[model samples]
Target: MNLYQKLVEIRKDVINFSKDTESFGYKYVSGSQAIAKIREKMDDLGVLLVPEVKNTISSTYDYINAKGKECTDHIVSGEMSYKWINSDNPEETLIVPWQLYGAQDDISKAFGSGLTYSERYFILKFFQAPTDVDDPDSRDTSNRGKGNKKGLSEAQVKRGYALGFKAGYDKANVDKQILSKFNKKIQDLTKEEYEIVCNGYEKRGGK
Candidate 1:
């Protein structure tokens, strides 16, 4: 990749690693930003990304290629499998990867599917290129959840949990105990909130 392109990709890598991005009203993150986050982790082998949908970018899997909470059984199709295990507790939940079914050609094009495993497993630090915009800052200060400053809805959060589980994090291993504390957080929130937290507990790709 050229310097300009590499610079752009670096920006994407950082933003991608910044948050869990799975629960409750995830906000919009531009392609550039996502790329910045993706670049940061390219240096390490801890990441497991999916194949790209486009031939131009197919050879290398950027953040755009990974499936949110790898739900498909590797033997079944893409040679992939993911399940969230609580590092804090044994009460782990198996999340079936839920792809946002639509007219899109592949996983990257499909929004609302869920948080990609990469997004959940690490904290993405944006490169903060000289020209990058602070998207959150552009939103209305008074606005609560509907602006760019807003975040992924409750549904998205659940998808992230699934990805984390599938990636093998173990349910919130706070003190070496498996626990889905988010379940409690979602339990009193709303139906959408509840699904995001509890549904991931269900299995994906039959055992």
Candidate 2:
């Protein structure tokens, strides 16, 4: 079988990793847990997953908080290349590239966090691994009186709309074009419409 087919087979057998760590009142599967599972299967599949750190950039922003306290934000951006190698053929290989950004008060902390974050997502996506918990960023909309319309909360809709508008407005008033195509205002858009606009923004590399 080809590398891609082998990957699909592997994904079928993979199990959802348990969340063994908690922070900020949220539970998540740590990078260590995810990598350990992948490592256990790599030898049998004759595939080696390697991550190379390509580049890193750092920037600092100064601002004041609501209390008028001076603050600084240090952001670290990193690029990573993940490679899947077939040991038997040595000629069959797959590469996936990813970029991630992290921010913290300490410079070293920012870069360290970004690197770990990138590595975790790289492994997860490549292996199509499942997690026991939903993404923390996702909101539970069932109790919000809207009866979980299309599985999105009112807050999520608002946030997605705002992101879409930001992307469109910054790019030649594309927001109006998107709204016109949907024939609806931002607040009135359905979950699918909001997702479409948000996806368009992502396709345009608008973060």
Candidate 3:
């Protein structure tokens, strides 16, 4: 079998790998999980998968915090490449390109996070793994009582909203001032508006 045929078989086998892990307001298979599964099958098929950072860019911003303390934020972006090699024919290889961005108070954290993020998605996209449903907090409206003062239950909305806010702020690089224009706390945002924010964040590669 050729590289493409082996890859198609691998995708069929692992595409439904359960997203048993959750964090950061999203559900996804971790890099370790995906890699383990992929490596296991690829080895049996006599194929190899390799990932490398092709290039990276880093930037720092200095700003004042709400408490008037000086703060520095570092952002790093990377171009990643994933290679599939056929053992039988050393010359046969396929490459997929991916991009990643991460920001943090520490420069090392920023780059580390960027690399992990890139690798995680690279596995998912390259093999077409399925992500589980949206976070439960974003989906369950059962607690939303009819004619309740708040359209959405506070408890149910809080987790999702917090996740969305952090993702928007961190990954999308959304400005707090833009959110302030909405004139309401995140939990108080109408369902429609809240979804819009979340969607925008994801569109900006928050996920």
Candidate 4:
């Protein structure tokens, strides 16, 4: 089969979430898990997937921690391209673009984190891995009855968890930071407060 045909076959394969890869109280399909499964399929089909970093930009941001102490962190943002090459016909290939971001207190780790985050997300997204989690928009009255509608939305909570993990913070550290700043758990944070938390993570707690 050709590269596209092989990819379509791969897409038809079922990739279940790794129940052991838990973060923020939910199981996710980890990068290694996806790679392992996909790699097997690729080898069977004589297909190759390669990633190339196109460009990256780095900068520093200043922000206040949950302890109200000012801190600076290195942030990296970049684009990468992935190539799907046909093993038999080396000239046949398809390229896809991916945008990624990462932040850390250590300059040495910023770009590495960004690359790893990008690759994980790319694999999951491209493969359409089953996360076994319902979409936030699927809820109608379930959240309304709990009065959680007045607090952070399900989408915001997921985003917060994702950003926190990407920035190399564990669930305990994330909740501790939130509690220190707002005296509330993630589920209790208002939309505005959640925005502050997201800003801290995405923008390195700046401004």
**lDDT-based ranking, best first?**
4, 3, 2, 1
User: Tens-digit lDDT track for model 4 on 28-89?
Assistant: 66667777778888888888988998655565555555367987777665557888898989
Per-residue CA lDDT of model 3 for 52-160, tens digit only, reads 7765656665555436798776776645677899998868899887765666789899878777877777777677676635634336453345454564553323233
TM-score of each: 0.24, 0.59, 0.60, 0.63
Find the candidate with the highest lDDT and give its number: 4
Q: Candidate 2 regions off by >4 Å?
A: 63-69, 139-207
Sorted by TM-score (best first), the order is: 4, 3, 2, 1
For candidate 1, write residues 56-102 as lDDT tens digits.
11111112222344232110011223333333332433332322211
What C-alpha lDDT does candidate 2 achieve relative to the native structure? 0.62
TM-score of 4: 0.63
Residue 42 miss distance in model 3 (angstroms): 1.4
lDDT of 2 by residue, 25-111 (tens): 667667898778667677777877777776555655454543679877566554568888888777899988776556667988877
Cα displacement (Å) at residue 38, model 2: 0.9
Whichever of 1 and 4 has more lDDT, that candidate is 4
Position 133, candidate 3: lDDT: 58
Residue pairs that clash (backbone atoms under 3 angstroms), model 3:
none
Checking candidate 2 for backbone clashes, the offending pairs are none
Q: Model 4 has how many clashing residue pairs?
A: 0
